[model samples]
Target: MTGYLPVVGAAMSITEYDQHRDWILEKQRDLELQDFITADVLNGNWEHLAEEVLAKLDGYTGRLGIHGPFWNLDISAADPEIRQIVQKRLDQGLDVCRKLKATHMVVHSPYTTWDQHNLDQYDQGHSFKLQCIQENLGAVVAKAEDIGCTLMIENIEDVDPSIRVELVKSFNSNAIAVSLDTGHAYYAHGSTGAPPVDYYVKAAGPLLQHVHLQDADGYADRHWAIGDGTLQWPALFNALQKYTNHPRLILELANNANLPKSMRYLSEQGLAQ
Candidate 1:
């Protein structure tokens, strides 16, 4: 796998997709749609939006997915009512996936820095959290399986990298898998005393089915272009070679205009296309 340039792609909003339509369609690169991540889009009548997107993507053929709604929606909430809302939001995301024929949806991880420190203090604490997650996502997972979409649990505020890997494994379903966010992992490393970004790739191994490739300073989720931050792109790409999963490496940047710069940085380093 030495000198391997993995299949790289972009996670773009509908407008961004249109802006880069020619380049994306020319390369036939993989894509993760980001329009449905907002609450307004989820709560509104989005069928027309979906139809418009389908129309725009008429000639494109590539691996397609979407960033699911994760705003203030906790999939591991202890309260049944909160969990119901979370489930409803996720079900809506799946409906979008079904409409677009997407095969993956990126979801936020439930683990936190507090869970890293306190989950072991009580014997039931860890089990109870797992129970809550299972209860909340059981139906959603089944729907994902039925619709041929894998729900990728992405790391956010997670100090322990393996926590998400274990959580994904606990589901025992193919529809659930791990998703790594480079900026989020770097934040944990610099701000929370966790391991570096590459360790996360190693930890998730084959379970990592998707990735949000962003560069950051380890202070916040900067979502900058690949060379604009302090992350070790070479090391992370080196670690990625150990897995056979060939995960979807989607550039999830803050500014869609910087997509070319990001890809240029990776290509110059011989890391990705």
Candidate 2:
């Protein structure tokens, strides 16, 4: 908590939270919510579980974040109708964040190689895509600002950092920032031929707000705990030190049970105290 905002993923449901409550309470860590908790926001299926979840977290005194719904929901959809749906879902997610008193929310960038190709062949295709993102996200950020929340747009299938940087900078809103997932970046490095993971942190620089700290082989998004897979952590952290003063660091492991192992690895490496 000294140099970064360290948090653990509170698994999707209250049931899952019960399983990890002991360890979470013992460690006194903050939380980054799993996608399941907010999945209903996309379909307008509110389970009214926020009050229940808040009750369970009564004693926690750390910051909270939610991984917003992104399953088949593209905010930058070219279709106006689809974009409207995207806005509705994100607005619901923002309402949830406000209810939970969570300042940071993680949202996915809708950029993909396929989309890029489709967007091409038209004059100012890239500009059109940027406009789509800016127009949609600009409205979303207005709501986020109303709720006093910041949306951290994460790279999903990004082939490079520049586009993602541009997407965030286009909004130019304090409520919009970037979230770097190390595992995703590592997997993208091989799968999409993206720059090294550290380059992303450096590129995002001051705009970097949240980080999903996990490891993965270049082949797939294994989400293995740090050090369990090959990632240049020393170099990544060294580069990160200059960019953010206290970015939220969530150990976004595939299996929440590995939180201890991941936390221990960071501590043992003197990256976290």
Candidate 3:
């Protein structure tokens, strides 16, 4: 179903995904991958490359997830006009996905405005920020629904997870859900005192549609392969197993020679073959 965590994966480019096509297919069969994301293919040739790669990974059967444009993609602009501009990036991303026949698209929430101090700027009457987010998001959701694609909104560290929940609640659409980023949750826990989890994923478990899993150093947002870092793999896996959310799991590991070892290490941590 849509909820089975896939442990599907990615690479630096289409050429890399093609190079590992056999491996990806073999692993998909072995692991029963339900969904996965491709690495950033921002040069606009993503459509052509994705088509070729999917044809090669024919043995693989699963859902596909795509990460929308990330560099300076201000989906949460404070300005209404600029917010409209940012929304176009997400639209373009889905246009690419529609061409590739993808089902779910992961997008980021708007960032809170911070001065040089990076303090709580929300109290500075920043509720309008959420309005901008909603306006852009509503538009994207309309497009996604037209194509029968789901928009999975990922959580950011600075924004309270509760806020994310509220945002979803505000829109109240079936076409929208949450994409919990594990590494981001870990990085959000800084010396400045952040809650363990915004409970965004756990709270919105039912609507939790996608996952991006990776191990991190508990400080930097290093997307290390599983087991190469400090995250408690067994515990996390166990929690996931019991989760009613049943979000699709994408291994979402770093692309490097270290991948083989990392994959094996995770299999030992409750992800049985």
Candidate 4:
């Protein structure tokens, strides 16, 4: 919405998109599709479904992003066989990106407090897990490079930004970067000792490529509209302006009904156009 960066909306499914398409078209906001492509992968027709979705969006001129298939697919799985499945899912996501000509794809991080608890399970559990992630994503990064799509690794259960930032830098590829989820950061801060939202912006800095902008009560990932929860919106915006202006800020609201309200909040606050 601003000259410095793009502000977008999130759609969890095609049905949700259809329900909110009028508002989205009216605003001409870009979108991040969460479960839309994932459902196609599960239903065994993502290729065809991707073409259908692309055709539907042909008249709607805006950038596109996809939240890849990350549910239960751990790229850093200890088992080699399981890791292969993870790689396959990511490859499928890349193929879908190629078809849709999506600008970004968000992948979930496998790190959690559980890794710290199971430290002795490996030589150095944290480092080993990071290595596993690097290896798995390294394979997919090549496809990402070939397709000219940027892969964003998002924080889910991370207690801090260090691990995710380290993972992104280790790739050292423009094709890969970091995706920060606001609600997840608050949830981690409340439950697992992660820092506040501004800390993530400062920590990620330039590597931060995309964001899932949702509000929460600091206990659960509520995914409410931007101003409806405990997050400090003004401070977060200032921190982002100081740290970087490159990340795409996406409003990932749970209920489609709240999308318009959330957009109005961003515009009224002068954070977006």
Candidate topping lDDT: 1
Task: At residue 225, give the lDDT of candidate 1.
Answer: 91
- Candidates' C-alpha lDDT: 0.91, 0.76, 0.62, 0.80
64: Cα error in model 2, Å = 0.7
Badly placed stretches (over 4 Å) of model 2 are 1-13, 22-28, 35-47, 115-122
**How well does candidate 3 score on lDDT at residue 205?**
53
Candidate 3 stretches with Cα past 4 Å from truth are 1-12, 27-47, 112-126, 197-200
Writing each residue's lDDT as its tens digit, candidate 3 over 130-247 gives: 6767777888888888887788787655445565666677777777887777777677754223455434455555666676777786686788987777865555555566566556
Residue-wise C-alpha lDDT for candidate 4, range 1-273, written one tens digit per residue: 233434566655665778878766775666787654454564587777777787667567766888888878887887888888888888888887888898789888888778645765777776887788878878799889999999988889888677789888888889999889999998988888888888988888988878889999999999998789988877677777765455777887888788778878887877764
Judged by whole-model lDDT over C-alpha atoms, candidate 1 comes out at 0.91
Please provide TM-scores, in order, for all candidate models, with all chains considered together: 0.97, 0.89, 0.80, 0.90
List model 2 lDDT by residue over 76-183, tens digit each: 787888888778778878888888887888889888867645656878888988887887777789989888888988887777787788888887788999888888
lDDT at 36 for candidate 4?
40
Q: Give the least accurate 10-residue stretch of model 1, judged by summed lDDT.
A: 1-10
Cα RMSD for candidates in order: 1.1, 2.9, 4.7, 2.6
Off by over 4 Å in 1: 1-3
Q: What is the C-alpha lDDT profile of model 1 across 101-152, one tens digit per residue?
A: 9999999988889988988999899889989999999999999999999999
| Candidate 2: pairs in clash | none
RMSD of 1: 1.1
* Model 3 lDDT at residue 179: 71
Report how far off residue 97 is in candidate 2 (Å). Answer: 0.9
Q: How much does candidate 3 score in TM-score?
A: 0.80
